[model samples]
Target: MMITQVRRPATQLARLASLPSAASRPTLNTPWRRFASGKSKSNVSSHWFRNSFGFALAGTATYLGYTYMNGDWEAWIERQKEVKKEVIDVNDLRADFIQEKRSLKSPGVYTWGSNAHKVVAPESKDSDVKIPRRFKYFNGQVLRDFKIDEKSGAAITENGDLVQWGKGYSETEYKPTKTLIGKNLTSLALSESRIVALSSNGTIYSLPISKHDQGNGPKLRESSWMPFWGRQSTLSYRVLRPSLKLGESVTLIRGGLEHVVLLTSSGRVFTAAASTEHYPSLGQLGVPGLSFITRPSGPVDTCHEVTSLKGSKITQIASGDYHSLALSNDGRLFAWGDNSFGQLGVEFLPEHPFNDTPSALPLKKLYRLSIYSPKVTSIAAGGANTFFTVDSKRILGPEEDTTKVRDLGRITADTWSCGRGVWGTLGAGKWIHLQDSPIKVKDLSGLGEYDEKTKQMLPIRLRTMSVGTTHVAALLNNKTNLSAKNTDALDKSSDWGYEAFWWGGNENFQLGTGKRANLARPAYIKAPSESSKTPEPEARLQIMPRHKGKVGKRNVSMEQRVECGRHVSAIYSAV
Candidate 1:
């Protein structure tokens, strides 16, 4: 339509220009003046022909040029419209991003751009249905990690299989029907196969796996799994320092990015190399001087049993990408190694290069940094961060007996996420690069609240969360149990009440049981709840404003395979 209109103007202008002016030219019928002008009939014909031909030629050229120019104009107009549409699309997308970001700030779950999914807990029923333990158990590779259910003594692998450990107990619903051909497992760690399991009576076993054999079938060696360090590379003149001594057996194993640390129940700490000469990866090993040693050079350096620390027993230890955390029974936490991101949670210490050499400076000369002095109950370490949950404010003396004391419940300061880089893993979208102090994830306000009148601006309680290489998986306690009709916890019915919700990272199936889409925040996982008997919709990310209604309906069932780092382990309390 616009093209036709544009061509009409050029055609009209060419037509007007081609017309002769009657005042400028003599009329052809005025032949009396033609004799005096010496005009002939042939000349008259030639003149008429020239005028007609010239007019035709001029009009054709003008029309052709105008057509070409009109075509360009039309093209420009269309290009402008396209550009405007693109601008609008970009603006809408940005606005959606901002809205989703704001939604994440609410206490309930929300999606960013990843494949986050929501999970609801089942509603309470007056009558109890007995689900056989055997039905819950299956035989599979304990890929990431395995944990024993405290109540049932059933071992669950990373692949979601539950295996019964004891004799006669294997007949329960939680037990795998078939016998597992390999190791009688205890516990498993992700990325590395440094399995920590105990024999029936109480003998601790550690199985060390070489990197080359990560995919091999489960093979258990009945000795303490200790990794010894050989001499440093001769090609480099730099002398590597040794951290943990392997002469002593490892009682506890925690895997980090590239490095692994072993802590004896007796309170001694040992570590081993994470990298090889072939390739060097970051977070692969502790600082150069912090490498693992086969033998201690001296008594002070020897990895002997620690009986000191004011008689406080060492209960737990956590290793981060570069740092290590130790928690004693006394509730005091000891940290060493990298301080760059403040994973140590120690404040006042001047920031230094995150290496063993820099952190090895004299204590008196180095600034002492303090982060939190909470009476720690447990600690967890991630790629470049560490988290510690504490028990109470008033730390009890090691000699004090509290078995009879009423549990006042633990006081956790608030959840915080800290790390390096710009991958948007930390829930706090604004923070980037290394952080020396822990920062609470943004948009996590109002967790565990039941009513708008009682909504908390800050989370009072957070439980059971895991951090991946780039995302986080957390199971939050709603603080109340009720029917499925309650939508306060992510508009989720009671069916999803106590289950789990995943947020962050959609590129990989990190969010679990959802369409592979990256999310900006947390969302409910609805697919797992759909029974195989019912027709289910196709899987998709829940980040969009409206859920796709038809996709899943056509496909009765869809199964998604997720590869968790070796295994996904969590601490659960069966109430």
Candidate 2:
């Protein structure tokens, strides 16, 4: 050992080099890492701190990169700020209106029963009873136009002012209250939780419905109202022009549970989901099987014109819970969207049994159905059913008047129904559960009385019809005499008054028959007044003097209009 130590200079130099120097190496006992054996705690801590700092810097860089790449960093920062709160003053939203003296002879609005929200007039002193009540607030005001949904109602006065009422979070308007006073409203549409109004100037206004305080359960609530006139407003309404490219004007608008269908003056049809969440389900927008590579960010804020209905002059549109129906000027019908209960009026196939799986059927586009011989005059859609009013006579040339043609002493208008009939909503007959194609409603031939002298039944022509979630209300022309020779006399004495018939679900007395039982066949609904004849037509005085006029005795009401809702019904009449 002594001899080797004297000669091992290379080994000695290697050992000296292996030992760490104080300048370059850390001490054994350091605060960061004290429990160490042979390892220098400071060195270990410095290495660990360097590696950890590098990892932390890398993690921070990665997060920043991710947020920047996704474009959410700014939004996240904005969300962290304290937002200024604002309150809407109802008085500011209202106009300075003075009630003018109204005539006793003006038309009245009558609503039957209640739904999730009560339909009582806001001016009504009685709060307990909520069934078949006349709105006294509308007594003096002439209701030029009106629309209703499950929980709300809107009307346009003859003066062009808009009136609205019903249960919403903002206010529970039991009575008709004036709104958007200076702006003349031409039309309005109501959905489950929203109201859309079209002004005479071609502007659109929307208001969010609050659901917390006034319903069976809580639902989505919008905090403010907006007017879509020229520019989009986050709190107020937005203009639906350049964004939607709806041209300069909109002619008609129809709203469903969560969507809206618009008809432009140029005969274009466009649809929009009420909210952004529904954009993925754009089939409701009438663009079937539409797929987007990137998720939309409130694209429904604007609307897309339905290309499938191109070149067709769409005149009318009707919407249900999850489906839509469009009628063209050429008497063609197009249906699309949900067909879970055969509401689309398309033939049922085994592969496409229900609309539960939208991908399988991809019923995003509208389809024209091969309806029967008679041309369709009007269409109405319910929650799960569709109703069509067809001209009973064949297509007439331009020189002919179909109204002049009488069939077997009856001027009949056929009503065809398709879709879900679980509650007899189709009104075809008892035990008919569902119909995929339009079928003429049965037992409608006897809508009028039988003429004993002619040994034939008098005709009852469908004047106008409305379909509810589970019921139907039809205004029928009850012609008493069918053999009159004078066309003028026939026109004068044809009893232009309309009788209302109701069928289908009556669980809430929506049939207005003072009963709550479902009706398989159509049943007569009594008029609000017991008078044998309706008030004399005001137009009659202009033609014939009051004393010398040959006024026809009409059992039905005059200027009659019927509208139905989820579990409620309404009638407008001039007493």
Q: Over the stretch 310-349, how does candidate 1's per-residue lDDT look in tens digits? A: 2545677666655666677766665665666555554425
lDDT of 2 by residue, 437-460 (tens): 666686553255677777876546
Cα displacement (Å) at residue 69, model 2: 99
For every candidate, C-alpha RMSD to the true structure in Å: 20.6, 32.2
Please report the candidate that would top lDDT against the real structure: 2
Q: How far is candidate 2 from the true structure (C-alpha RMSD, Å)?
A: 32.2
In candidate 2, residue 251 scores what lDDT? 76
Off by over 4 Å in 1: 1-183, 191-252, 263-312, 338-342, 345-352, 355-377, 390-413, 442-460, 478-499, 513-523, 529-575
lDDT of 2: 0.59
Superposed Cα deviation of residue 318, candidate 2 (Å): 1.3
lDDT, each prediction:
0.39, 0.59
